[model samples]
Target chain A: MGSMARAKVVALSMVDKHPEPQPLLAVKLSPAENPTAEAGADAAAPINSSALPAPEPEVVPTVSLTKVFRNLLAQITRERITTAALACVSIGALFLFWYIGTKYRVEFYIRFKNVPTPYEVFQQLTQVGLSNKYLVNIAISVRRILLGFFIAMAIGVPLGLAIGKYQRVRDLFMPVVEILRPIPAIAWVPMSIMLWPNNEASIVFITFIGAFFPILLNTIHGVHSLDGVLIRAAKCLGASEFRLFLNVILPGSLPHIFTGLAVGMGVAWVSLIAAEMISGQFGVGYFTWEAYSLVDYPAIVLGMITIGFLGLACSGIIRMVGSLLMPWLAFAPGGKR
Target chain B: MIMATAMAETQKGLIDVRDMGVTFGANDNKIIAVDNVSLNVQPGEFVSLIGPSGCGKSTLLSIVAGFVKPTSGDAKLDGNAITKPGSDRGVVFQQYSLFPWLSVRKNVEFGLKMAGLEQSKRNTTARALLDLAELLSFENHYPDQLSGGMKQRIGIVRALATSPQVLLMDEPFGALDTQTRVVMQEILTNIWQQFKISVLFITHDIEESIFLSDRIYVMTARPGRIKAEIKVPLPRPRRAEMTDTPEFMNLVQELKGLIREESLAAMAPEIKDRGLSGFGMKVGPKGVGDIF
Candidate 1:
């Protein structure tokens, strides 16, 4: 890739690699603009700076292969170095636990040794990374999640608004929503398979079911939580119902809608994986299940990590879209004093 | 056009409230919030409705603004029977209800947009109003970005944007600091004079009412009715210093006595157990009482 493209990829994927948020600990990773101070202020002090090994010297003079590799770290910004160091420590801590737990075969209820170690998982990722079948599995899962999430949004936003505004619409649909909301997406596998013509459709349907409730309920709640004064203000300004809905209700409910969309994106990934595993020709979920059957523990762990990456990407994209749509939220006036 | 004409025919009184009464809830549990209150605001006149807390001042304004219906009497504007909220009777709520999502200019332009003005016309109107209110500089800021006083100025201009025939304000400056309140009162009177628009303002502050109003209506306690109508004999182009004048102070003292009497009655021990004694308001079953 071109240098510009590589930088773009780095910027976009920086936060997308992590499965969980470290909102306080997360720094923006700009070029040495003093991020450590901010990261410290909000989160636990960046994995204790002393615990991080000193960054190797610059690569300007030394040309030995291993030394060159170590010195190459100098090219990265201080913020990135700190982040990388913290991430390395975090991942190392997790692996340390996994290695010790599995080596001793520690048992909670069952044998923890059954789970592959971090080394085993990385080896499996390396073996499968170049394979076309794994790529296709990832492709299938992503396609299902995107399609299902889109369908959920298309159906959820309008329906949510209708249910929110009118009491009668709410009364009519709420019972069904309440009844269906509690059922897990996996439990719907049988019915979804029966209803759809093929596994692809069934898997997408399950994903949609997982996402639909959060967005719908959130939209309804957004409408309910809207300040009555705004509506009154609009009406008193001579706004017709249509105008009121367009100018006030829609915008007023946006903060809530975005929240619902973000949560729905998370659930969509979760359900898509499970649904694909239960019944699918191909997907990361199916790949994991297939690996389990073959007793390929490393490949199964690799699949799990891939799912985590996918979930992070989905949620990250939603967060980006939310900030873009509502610039006001990102720009607070003065200090919050 | 037909509706405007019909409204003109019916609007013999510029703003007519005839023995209007409002009772919230029903039957035995019913509480009379406003009682047989009748008043008017002539064309180009600024009228203030002032009373002790919970004397139904806001409720009366709400009726005129068509957000609430009068149980017995009717509220009419320009001969048109006010039924529902309309642009013809623009309203400025005390809460500074500038849509937080909209910019200051857009907040002012909202009513104009709803009135179906063309883009250029809406822009012109909003800009002129903002310029008049000296909010042109902060026009791009959101409501949350502006100070409380700035937000209320935006609210006032927004109400005036549609060129409503009669403006109804419910304690438009009640939330501001005392200093900001005085400044806002000055800005409001100037705008009222510049536009020559009829106004029906509701406020609990006696000094604020007399400073901006052409006449002040003092209302009695619970089941609020008009107690006395004190016309401001003060000449046009009112200033803050006018409050120091003996005449203004005497009127302030006179109104204060009337408000205190009603306030004492509103605080009467018979219903005091409900935590009823609210300054300048009526006794509602709700947590606090502000209107009678």
Candidate 2:
């Protein structure tokens, strides 16, 4: 008998030997008429009616090298074109919006309807050299942002680690943080001026408040989310409490710390601009405000562009640091944008 | 063939546990994990700890390795009390406890670094242990890049790099496939024969216990006491086929009997009320496949 007939016999015997009635007949048997029509009806009859069924059909090998290569090439081309198209559309759209928006400006004091073109903004950026008052304004902003960022990191990272690692400390400080965190740094400008009596102190306080929460939250999350298994493994390997926290916990939490730093840096840049504009004698925000007062739309656009570019640079540096510190974690699938 | 001499070798204790106990949580909410239990493990011996789930077999092993401090009594290694985890007692955890960031070589060197060995000594010991574990070729590979068996092998090498007197493995092969578990069992046996460091292997597999250990220390449920200390007389470098033998079969039957009794006894009203029907299924057909 053929394999099909032999399989049928085996199936029949399996049912007989077990002597257990299966309530659910999970298997489906197609009518033999289709196969019988394909072959001769008489020829298929004995095979179907036989005590045993056939063994499974052997897999046939068929190779087409050209077809395989064609598919691979098609996949590569499709991916490449899609990525390139996406890049072009995104950059094109951004430039288009910026160009259209800057083409017109309403200067109420000057009563001018149409401003100079977007190219004038680019020309103004080039003319604003090292000695230009605008360049000094840029310098002042960069210095304050950097200083405030560093100060925030100095305070935030350690406090974050304590809050993340210990419950009592987290409880004690969490309420205070919750109360302070909701009060916007812009709103604190009046309070800062009264407390410190200087524009510099106010700007720094605003930047510190703006940058603090993100760094703190990220650091806490990084510490809290450390692998339980890794900690257990470290404990098993005789790692002392100090070594465990420093070597394992610190390194493990670094990725989150970097995330916090990136977010904190962004917040500091934005808040410092607002603070500088509202109170400071110099800096990018003050420069932008001063340009608005003078109705120099090109310089106003320049200040905004410089802020955008500087924020991008700061975040890029943070990302580079994160990748360097966590080379193992860097290759995560889809790469977080 | 089974031999009585193997059983004779395991009688002289290499590891002595005297009335050990452990209590977790604070004051009024305290729960006893392991209550006063004593066990003895001989040098050049493979002893298995088999018990119902939550019976404190793992707790008992952790105490032996000094990973867990006992509330009462002591776990002694070669007559000295084990107060803290040391390089002398190497432990293999259930999960892949390898440092994911480090390559295989660096992971193996971790214990040596902790021991304050110089670079030269650390490299030599790490290399030798890796070679013994048959993972020398994959030395530069990270733990994530390796297969389950390879990762566990690295874990073994890392533990052995310290030249630990006692290999306190807590279900090292528990996460592997049956085929891989068999392969790892052979690898472990070969390593045991070469080093003969007294092994306190904690497992719930009756067949595995029979296949690997020189003696089986069956533990009771809750207040986990030593139920029986049956000597397995299987010859050195035990083959996978030894599990098919009458001696191995009989021992497996005895262990299964003890485990079932203890498992039934452990089925308290609280557990029944909690509806944890699948508890301690490692020693039976219900969840026997889980315990490597």
**Per-residue accuracy of model 1 over A1-337 as CA lDDT, tens digit each:** 2433443354345445643323321332221123233333322223343343332333211223433454466668887789999999999998898889888889988788678877778887788897999999999899999999999999999899989999999999999999999998889999999999988899999999999999999999999999898999999999999998889998889989999999999888889888877888899999999999999888988988899898988889888887777666643455222
TM-scores computed on chain B for all candidates? 0.88, 0.85
In the range B1-292, model 1's lDDT, one tens digit per residue, is 3553464454433787898989999999998989988888887778999888888999999888888988888888876789999888889998869887888888999998998999899888899999999989988877888889998988988998887888899998889899999999899889988887789999989888998888899999887989999889998899888889999989989999898778767876654444444533654355545333
Using DockQ as the measure, the top candidate is 1
- Over 4 Å off, model 2: A1-81, A98-117, A129-131, A166-175, A195-198, A331-337, B1-13, B25-30, B267-292
Which predicted model would earn the best TM-score? 1
Give the TM-score (0 to 1) of chain B in model 2: 0.85
CAPRI verdict (incorrect, acceptable, medium, high) for model 2:
incorrect
